[model samples]
Target: MSERPVSTTDLDSYIADLRQLQARRRPAEIPDHVVYPAGEITIPAHVSHWAAQRPATTALTFEGTAFTYPELDDLHRRLAGWMADQGISRGDRVAVYLGNSPEFVIAFLAILRLGAVHVPVNPMFAPAELTHELRDAEPGLVLTNRALASTVEEVQPRLDSPVPVLIVEDGWADAIAHEPFTGDDGDLDALAALNYTGGTTGLPKGCQHTQRHMLYTAASATTATQLSAEPGFTSLCYLPIFWIAGEDLGILLPFVLGGTSVLMARWDAATTLDAIEAFGVSVMTGTVENYLELMARPDIGERDLSSLVDPQAVSFVRKMTPQVRADWAAAAPSSGTLRESSYGMTETHTIDCVPYGFAADDEDLLAEPVFCGLPVPGTDIAVVEFGTQTPLPLGEVGEIIVRSPSVTDGYWRNPEATADQLVDGWIHTGDNGRIDEQGLLHYLGRRKEMIKVKGMSVFPAEIEVLLAQHPLVESVAVVPTDDPDSGQRPVAFVLPAEGATVTAEELVSWSRENMATYKVPLVKVIGALPMTATGKVRKHELAEDAAALNR
Candidate 1:
């Protein structure tokens, strides 16, 4: 897979290709305050306010069940009492290992209602992955559905102290209906959650966030999306709530907007479109793949999608490029704008820079690769020199530094990692990017993921984004392999479009003509690219495959 393509010898011959061609930068302008209703600022506060004011309004709809705001609040309050009785209390960690369902939301808020730290574990985790989280979090209790209960049970005995597991079932209503939690609310500054984040490299690390952090994320995101309760704001939640991105879009955003969420356990283009048409879903947020899949469906244009507005898109396995936005607008005329969702990480509770309606205003902004629009209101984003931490000039690519209200307290129980990553108040995002003169941030890629070929730096994401433009390419992942001459060389694993008979040589030729000679990578055809549960490419897996070929 890592073998150099014969058609391209400019990499080895390398005479006049020191400078890599770069796309012109056109940054989007940051906005002032995003419009959001004042008052109720926290999740519990929102629940309480809505329950008292708009009790009959539906807050969540799952499968065939619907719960009004008051009913939803009441049920979680009862569950919180049950958790309290099970020895979960303020500051205690309670892990909710469940899929996307009403149960997940119920368990989540119930845990928070008790002032306990909510630890969301991905249900797709295997026994080993599950064990690592449980061990690190050391939760006082675990909540899961019947199907996932055994996975928790399997990992419980491995913990230093066995933790209690509660299966969220119908009987949960009976267990706590007689009693409701009357506990005091957690302090805004109190630790609220352990949002876990990781890659293909090592054990997942937990980012400690506070209720204040969560509240700011929820509120600012509401502003960013321009969500309003008037005339009703509704969204679809098919993405797993366990993920930071999912937690924000699926749960927090609606809570802040005082809107309704129509939940689906997972992604299915047909069901999502049906939900949008049936429920008048006004706003939608998901990966780029979701919108693409929707457009691919023949019935997309036929569906009654007049109510659906601009869908918030996250760039994960697939980037939200100019072409995608153009295609989406053509396929669904009602979609007002299609742009990258919030630019953040779990460390910032997932929203540091916000993108809303920017693409609609500036077509040039869409052309920038990995463009993360504007910092959150009241937050500071700085680009600094890699080693000295000296602030870099605008438009000069460097390390990104973000200090926001939504920034995490720190990594849980990992002082060494925390001290290294967090300085003063800013979180040093290991990502490489640059803020343009217009203030738009362009995330070049992960610093470690950059390939040093000959003497030039090549960003893998830029290569992948470029290759994906070809009509014959379905997907592509680029990984760096060691080279004797060049410090490292990019090896691309190409997934051709179905039934397309394009060969590696043809791809290499296309790359040589379309891209910089040094930037052109060795192309290898593959049936499928390895992916994580939340739709992230497993670059480590690809790198390993490339390493073996080199060996």
Candidate 2:
């Protein structure tokens, strides 16, 4: 790709051409109405609408317990009112620290209903990691289950102020007795949630999204993927609800379409298969790792998965091979030959490109590097030069930038970051990719040094800092190496302290104890790390070396 900056007129023309291509690929009519004419459509609005329209409809099912639309609405309303009684008002941030349970969904909707911002803390985060978010967000209250209340309490004293902690089980009775929230609709521009993403700076940054952004995400995803919200429309929720994609598919899409959502606390291949068969789940989305686990199950062949419709997978870590696709098709004969695939990030609330009615035999399209399909309706994407914002020509690798109604406003309380990333209404997604002649986007790799294990973003700087703390290690640099099943795994190059000795296995074991499973790096002992003349570690060189060593 040319480094020379393209003229503004030329760049605009290129963007226009890309949009035209996207228009050509768009469906004639999106199956559902994504855009709402109402001034400010919020999550609470969706819940209330569904509650009145389909009171008896099953809205959520979790571990043998089912909650109907009206029941869920009542719970959320009462919870919102209870939150108000606790002095939690609109614009205040409320952190939700819990696993994927009915309580997680209830708390999330309750926060939105109260017009408060929801801050989802990764349940896998260690106390220190959790503390960082608490200090940064300084939320008014943290809602957690009894199992995780200790973690929240541990981080409470570390915050700038003494924030209240609401244990879900203890609060449930009070919330049920509390009056339902009868507040007016929230302004579309009001902040809805603060999604924290790993930063290269070794800290987490919160992405501020508005009510309008949330609604648009749900609408665009539904329309682009042709997802149905009919009575039988059901989705498997195995992915973490803390993540953006998970929130989109698991909560927003189902609630908006008035479909049933089967909730799982975590990914378990066997349980997921059983749920799919039992509930007749028609929609599911997960990383390639998820599918591989299902395929590895001996009982997979016997399980009936015909209810699955257009199951999608993010093929970043491991490309879905022809054989795997064939096996999946055979296993779930009702879901045609091809399982859908797409590309997205947390910054953009939902996916950018969807297969938009792709057929199974379209191998030419699927062969592309995790072939990201065309842009969804009301979203525009461009491939621009890495450093400069100049648009690149088609078929050339460059930075991928996006402009969409659902794209986040900016990072919370981080104006410098906001200015650096959100430029001229376009989020400069530090992701590297190219647009083919057919208008499909192909993900080459990330321009940033972030490591993707499975579909989770793991920052190397965070891991390096932790590893460097070990007495056995003097220096360390983390790099990502391609993994057939995980998309990419982190490999750490460590130089032992002078006259000290440490084994790779020892460090790997230590990592498993100290960090989240996905963030743990595969240890590779090296005498010295490859570095440039300025003494900065050349991560690219180390990545190449790690790749070779892995092979």
Clashes of each: 0, 2
Which is the leading candidate under lDDT?
2
List per-candidate RMSD values in Å.
13.5, 3.5
TM-score of each candidate structure, all chains considered together: 0.76, 0.89
TM-score of model number 2? 0.89
Q: Give residue 9's error in model 1 in angstroms.
A: 49
Model 2 stretches astray by more than 4 angstroms: 1-8, 27-40, 292-306, 364-366, 467-475, 482-487, 494-514, 522-530, 541-551
Which residue pairs does candidate 1 place in steric collision?
none
